[model samples]
Target: MFLFYQRSVHTWFFLCNFSSRKWWNEETVAVVTGGNKGIGFGVCKQFSIAGLRVVLTARDADRGQEAHQKLKHEGFQNISFHQLDVTDAASRTSFAPWLLREHGGFNILVNNAAINGVAIDEVYSKENNISLKDFLVCIS
Candidate 1:
Protein backbone atom coordinates (compact mmCIF):
# COMPACT_ATOMS: atom_id res chain seq x y z
CA MET A 1 0.00 0.00 0.00
CA PHE A 2 1.05 3.55 -0.62
CA LEU A 3 0.14 6.58 1.44
CA PHE A 4 0.02 9.84 -0.44
CA TYR A 5 1.03 12.94 1.52
CA GLN A 6 0.63 16.49 0.37
CA ARG A 7 3.80 18.49 0.83
CA SER A 8 3.13 21.92 -0.64
CA VAL A 9 0.51 23.57 -2.85
CA HIS A 10 1.92 21.83 -5.90
CA THR A 11 3.61 18.76 -4.44
CA TRP A 12 2.53 15.27 -3.45
CA PHE A 13 4.83 12.74 -1.80
CA PHE A 14 4.20 9.03 -2.17
CA LEU A 15 5.29 6.54 0.48
CA CYS A 16 5.29 2.97 -0.71
CA ASN A 17 5.86 -0.36 1.03
CA PHE A 18 7.67 -1.93 -1.90
CA SER A 19 11.36 -2.45 -1.24
CA SER A 20 13.94 -3.96 -3.56
CA ARG A 21 17.31 -2.64 -4.64
CA LYS A 22 16.69 -3.66 -8.21
CA TRP A 23 13.14 -2.32 -8.34
CA TRP A 24 14.38 1.09 -9.34
CA ASN A 25 17.49 1.03 -11.51
CA GLU A 26 20.03 3.65 -12.44
CA GLU A 27 17.89 4.72 -15.40
CA THR A 28 15.04 5.72 -13.11
CA VAL A 29 14.50 9.47 -13.41
CA ALA A 30 12.65 11.95 -11.18
CA VAL A 31 11.82 15.56 -11.93
CA VAL A 32 11.27 17.92 -8.99
CA THR A 33 10.07 21.45 -9.66
CA GLY A 34 10.85 24.45 -7.45
CA GLY A 35 13.41 22.29 -5.70
CA ASN A 36 15.82 25.06 -4.82
CA LYS A 37 14.60 25.29 -1.21
CA GLY A 38 11.97 24.25 1.33
CA ILE A 39 9.71 21.21 0.79
CA GLY A 40 10.72 20.67 -2.82
CA PHE A 41 14.35 20.44 -1.79
CA GLY A 42 13.44 17.95 0.93
CA VAL A 43 11.61 15.79 -1.62
CA CYS A 44 14.59 15.94 -3.98
CA LYS A 45 16.93 14.87 -1.20
CA GLN A 46 14.73 11.94 -0.24
CA PHE A 47 14.43 10.77 -3.87
CA SER A 48 18.19 11.02 -4.34
CA ILE A 49 18.81 9.05 -1.14
CA ALA A 50 16.45 6.37 -2.45
CA GLY A 51 18.69 6.04 -5.55
CA LEU A 52 16.47 7.79 -8.10
CA ARG A 53 18.14 9.92 -10.75
CA VAL A 54 16.84 13.26 -9.49
CA VAL A 55 16.46 16.29 -11.74
CA LEU A 56 15.98 19.24 -9.40
CA THR A 57 14.45 22.07 -11.37
CA ALA A 58 13.65 25.68 -10.66
CA ARG A 59 12.61 28.73 -12.67
CA ASP A 60 15.72 30.59 -11.63
CA ALA A 61 18.97 29.14 -12.92
CA ASP A 62 21.10 30.53 -10.10
CA ARG A 63 19.05 29.01 -7.28
CA GLY A 64 18.80 25.71 -9.10
CA GLN A 65 22.55 25.66 -9.66
CA GLU A 66 23.12 26.50 -6.00
CA ALA A 67 20.92 23.60 -4.93
CA HIS A 68 22.73 21.28 -7.31
CA GLN A 69 26.05 22.36 -5.82
CA LYS A 70 24.85 21.93 -2.24
CA LEU A 71 23.51 18.45 -2.95
CA LYS A 72 26.75 17.52 -4.72
CA HIS A 73 28.78 18.88 -1.81
CA GLU A 74 26.76 16.64 0.49
CA GLY A 75 27.76 13.63 -1.72
CA PHE A 76 24.54 13.09 -3.65
CA GLN A 77 25.72 12.25 -7.17
CA ASN A 78 22.39 10.98 -8.55
CA ILE A 79 21.01 14.49 -8.77
CA SER A 80 21.20 17.23 -11.41
CA PHE A 81 19.46 20.53 -12.18
CA HIS A 82 17.31 21.98 -14.92
CA GLN A 83 15.37 25.24 -15.29
CA LEU A 84 11.59 25.13 -15.70
CA ASP A 85 8.72 27.54 -15.30
CA VAL A 86 5.56 25.60 -14.69
CA THR A 87 3.29 28.59 -15.18
CA ASP A 88 4.47 29.18 -18.70
CA ALA A 89 2.82 27.06 -21.33
CA ALA A 90 5.77 27.34 -23.70
CA SER A 91 8.17 26.11 -21.04
CA ARG A 92 5.85 23.37 -19.87
CA THR A 93 5.17 22.16 -23.39
CA SER A 94 8.87 21.75 -24.15
CA PHE A 95 9.96 19.84 -21.04
CA ALA A 96 8.48 16.46 -21.90
CA PRO A 97 10.19 16.23 -25.30
CA TRP A 98 13.44 17.41 -23.78
CA LEU A 99 13.23 14.78 -21.04
CA LEU A 100 12.33 12.05 -23.48
CA ARG A 101 15.22 12.86 -25.77
CA GLU A 102 17.83 13.40 -23.05
CA HIS A 103 17.04 10.89 -20.29
CA GLY A 104 15.03 8.47 -22.44
CA GLY A 105 11.97 8.83 -20.20
CA PHE A 106 11.18 9.70 -16.60
CA ASN A 107 9.54 7.44 -14.05
CA ILE A 108 8.71 10.04 -11.41
CA LEU A 109 7.59 13.63 -11.45
CA VAL A 110 7.06 16.09 -8.57
CA ASN A 111 5.38 19.40 -9.38
CA ASN A 112 6.32 21.52 -6.38
CA ALA A 113 6.27 24.97 -7.84
CA ALA A 114 3.67 27.61 -6.87
CA ILE A 115 3.57 31.27 -6.19
CA ASN A 116 2.37 32.33 -2.74
CA GLY A 117 0.96 35.44 -4.51
CA VAL A 118 1.91 37.61 -1.61
CA ALA A 119 4.25 40.54 -1.79
CA ILE A 120 6.65 40.33 1.12
CA ASP A 121 8.85 43.21 2.08
CA GLU A 122 11.78 42.04 4.17
CA VAL A 123 11.97 45.23 6.22
CA TYR A 124 8.38 44.88 7.32
CA SER A 125 8.89 41.22 8.09
CA LYS A 126 11.96 41.95 10.16
CA GLU A 127 10.13 44.70 12.02
CA ASN A 128 7.27 42.30 12.80
CA ASN A 129 9.70 39.50 13.62
CA ILE A 130 7.89 37.11 11.29
CA SER A 131 9.38 35.88 8.07
CA LEU A 132 7.44 34.94 4.96
CA LYS A 133 8.29 31.28 5.40
CA ASP A 134 7.31 31.39 9.05
CA PHE A 135 4.03 33.10 8.30
CA LEU A 136 3.15 30.64 5.58
CA VAL A 137 3.94 27.72 7.87
CA CYS A 138 1.85 29.19 10.65
CA ILE A 139 -1.15 29.83 8.42
CA SER A 140 -0.97 26.43 6.83
Candidate 2:
Protein backbone atom coordinates (compact mmCIF):
# COMPACT_ATOMS: atom_id res chain seq x y z
CA MET A 1 0.00 0.00 0.00
CA PHE A 2 2.48 2.56 -1.15
CA LEU A 3 1.46 6.03 -2.32
CA PHE A 4 3.41 8.41 -4.44
CA TYR A 5 2.83 11.60 -6.39
CA GLN A 6 3.92 11.48 -10.00
CA ARG A 7 4.39 14.90 -11.51
CA SER A 8 4.45 15.51 -15.25
CA VAL A 9 4.25 18.67 -17.34
CA HIS A 10 2.93 20.63 -14.33
CA THR A 11 0.28 18.03 -13.60
CA TRP A 12 0.20 16.13 -10.31
CA PHE A 13 -0.98 12.58 -9.75
CA PHE A 14 -1.88 10.57 -6.72
CA LEU A 15 -0.83 6.99 -7.40
CA CYS A 16 -1.54 4.15 -5.03
CA ASN A 17 -1.16 0.40 -5.08
CA PHE A 18 -4.37 -1.21 -3.87
CA SER A 19 -3.22 -4.72 -3.17
CA SER A 20 -0.22 -6.93 -2.65
CA ARG A 21 -1.03 -9.33 -5.47
CA LYS A 22 0.99 -9.09 -8.62
CA TRP A 23 -0.79 -7.79 -11.72
CA TRP A 24 -1.46 -10.04 -14.68
CA ASN A 25 -2.46 -8.30 -17.87
CA GLU A 26 -5.25 -10.61 -19.00
CA GLU A 27 -6.69 -10.78 -15.52
CA THR A 28 -6.22 -7.12 -14.57
CA VAL A 29 -8.61 -4.21 -15.01
CA ALA A 30 -6.89 -0.84 -14.56
CA VAL A 31 -8.41 2.62 -14.31
CA VAL A 32 -6.15 5.57 -15.09
CA THR A 33 -7.60 9.02 -14.45
CA GLY A 34 -6.51 11.94 -16.65
CA GLY A 35 -5.26 9.49 -19.20
CA ASN A 36 -5.58 11.98 -22.03
CA LYS A 37 -2.02 13.16 -21.64
CA GLY A 38 1.31 13.17 -19.79
CA ILE A 39 1.97 10.57 -17.08
CA GLY A 40 -1.57 9.24 -17.25
CA PHE A 41 -1.34 8.66 -20.98
CA GLY A 42 1.98 6.91 -20.59
CA VAL A 43 0.61 4.75 -17.80
CA CYS A 44 -2.30 3.69 -20.02
CA LYS A 45 0.07 2.81 -22.82
CA GLN A 46 2.31 0.75 -20.60
CA PHE A 47 -0.58 -1.12 -19.05
CA SER A 48 -2.20 -1.88 -22.39
CA ILE A 49 1.07 -3.09 -23.84
CA ALA A 50 1.42 -5.36 -20.84
CA GLY A 51 -1.97 -6.90 -21.83
CA LEU A 52 -4.11 -5.34 -19.12
CA ARG A 53 -7.60 -4.02 -19.82
CA VAL A 54 -7.07 -0.33 -19.09
CA VAL A 55 -9.83 2.24 -18.73
CA LEU A 56 -8.39 5.61 -19.64
CA THR A 57 -10.32 8.53 -18.18
CA ALA A 58 -10.17 12.27 -18.79
CA ARG A 59 -12.29 15.28 -17.78
CA ASP A 60 -12.80 16.25 -21.40
CA ALA A 61 -14.89 13.91 -23.54
CA ASP A 62 -13.29 14.82 -26.83
CA ARG A 63 -9.80 14.56 -25.40
CA GLY A 64 -10.50 11.26 -23.72
CA GLN A 65 -11.92 9.82 -26.92
CA GLU A 66 -9.02 11.12 -28.89
CA ALA A 67 -6.53 9.57 -26.53
CA HIS A 68 -8.45 6.32 -26.72
CA GLN A 69 -8.38 6.50 -30.50
CA LYS A 70 -4.69 7.23 -30.52
CA LEU A 71 -3.96 4.09 -28.51
CA LYS A 72 -6.33 2.02 -30.64
CA HIS A 73 -4.73 3.42 -33.79
CA GLU A 74 -1.39 2.36 -32.41
CA GLY A 75 -2.93 -1.16 -32.45
CA PHE A 76 -3.63 -1.73 -28.80
CA GLN A 77 -6.93 -3.54 -28.23
CA ASN A 78 -6.94 -3.75 -24.43
CA ILE A 79 -7.48 -0.04 -23.83
CA SER A 80 -10.77 1.87 -23.45
CA PHE A 81 -11.85 5.37 -22.41
CA HIS A 82 -14.24 7.09 -20.01
CA GLN A 83 -14.86 10.70 -19.01
CA LEU A 84 -14.00 11.59 -15.44
CA ASP A 85 -13.44 14.65 -13.28
CA VAL A 86 -11.68 13.52 -10.13
CA THR A 87 -12.41 16.76 -8.33
CA ASP A 88 -16.15 16.29 -8.54
CA ALA A 89 -17.79 14.45 -5.69
CA ALA A 90 -20.88 13.36 -7.62
CA SER A 91 -18.81 12.04 -10.47
CA ARG A 92 -16.70 10.05 -8.05
CA THR A 93 -19.80 8.55 -6.45
CA SER A 94 -21.16 7.43 -9.81
CA PHE A 95 -17.95 6.10 -11.27
CA ALA A 96 -17.14 3.51 -8.62
CA PRO A 97 -20.23 1.37 -8.97
CA TRP A 98 -20.27 1.67 -12.72
CA LEU A 99 -16.69 0.48 -12.93
CA LEU A 100 -17.42 -2.50 -10.72
CA ARG A 101 -20.49 -3.42 -12.75
CA GLU A 102 -18.93 -2.94 -16.16
CA HIS A 103 -15.47 -4.28 -15.55
CA GLY A 104 -16.48 -7.13 -13.23
CA GLY A 105 -13.40 -6.44 -11.13
CA PHE A 106 -10.72 -3.83 -10.73
CA ASN A 107 -7.09 -4.57 -10.04
CA ILE A 108 -5.47 -1.16 -10.24
CA LEU A 109 -6.33 2.53 -10.08
CA VAL A 110 -3.93 5.25 -11.20
CA ASN A 111 -5.34 8.57 -10.04
CA ASN A 112 -3.60 10.91 -12.41
CA ALA A 113 -6.00 13.86 -12.38
CA ALA A 114 -4.64 16.90 -10.51
CA ILE A 115 -4.67 20.59 -9.69
CA ASN A 116 -1.44 22.58 -9.99
CA GLY A 117 -0.45 25.59 -7.89
CA VAL A 118 2.42 27.32 -9.59
CA ALA A 119 3.12 30.43 -11.53
CA ILE A 120 3.45 30.03 -15.29
CA ASP A 121 6.09 32.70 -15.26
CA GLU A 122 9.19 31.18 -13.69
CA VAL A 123 11.16 34.44 -13.63
CA TYR A 124 8.45 36.38 -11.80
CA SER A 125 8.01 33.62 -9.27
CA LYS A 126 11.73 33.47 -8.62
CA GLU A 127 11.98 37.22 -8.32
CA ASN A 128 9.13 37.27 -5.82
CA ASN A 129 10.62 34.36 -3.83
CA ILE A 130 7.35 32.44 -3.92
CA SER A 131 7.39 28.82 -2.81
CA LEU A 132 5.06 26.03 -3.90
CA LYS A 133 3.15 26.18 -0.63
CA ASP A 134 2.18 29.75 -1.47
CA PHE A 135 -0.36 28.18 -3.81
CA LEU A 136 -1.14 24.87 -2.06
CA VAL A 137 -2.75 25.09 1.32
CA CYS A 138 -2.95 22.19 3.75
CA ILE A 139 -6.51 21.23 4.45
CA SER A 140 -5.89 20.33 8.05
Q: Each candidate's lDDT (Cα)?
A: 0.79, 0.77
Which parts of model 2 have CA positions greater than 4 angstroms off? 1-23, 116-140
**Could you give candidate 1's per-residue lDDT for residues 1-140 as a string of tens digits?**
23255647655454657764356767889898999998789888878876789989898889899999999999999998878887566887887688778888788888888654442344456757766678889999
Q: Clashes in model 2: which pairs?
A: none
Candidate 2 lDDT, tens digit per residue, 1-140? 33334456543433446576654748689899999998888888877766789999988889999999999999989887778887667887877888888898588888888644443355557855655555555432
Clash total of candidate 1: 0
lDDT of 1 at 132: 69
- TM-score of every candidate: 0.66, 0.65
| Superposition-based RMSD of candidate 2 using all C-alpha atoms, in angstroms | 9.9
Output the number of the lDDT-best candidate.
1
In model 2, the worst 10-residue window by lDDT is: 7-16
Indicate the worst ten consecutive residues by lDDT in candidate 1: 115-124
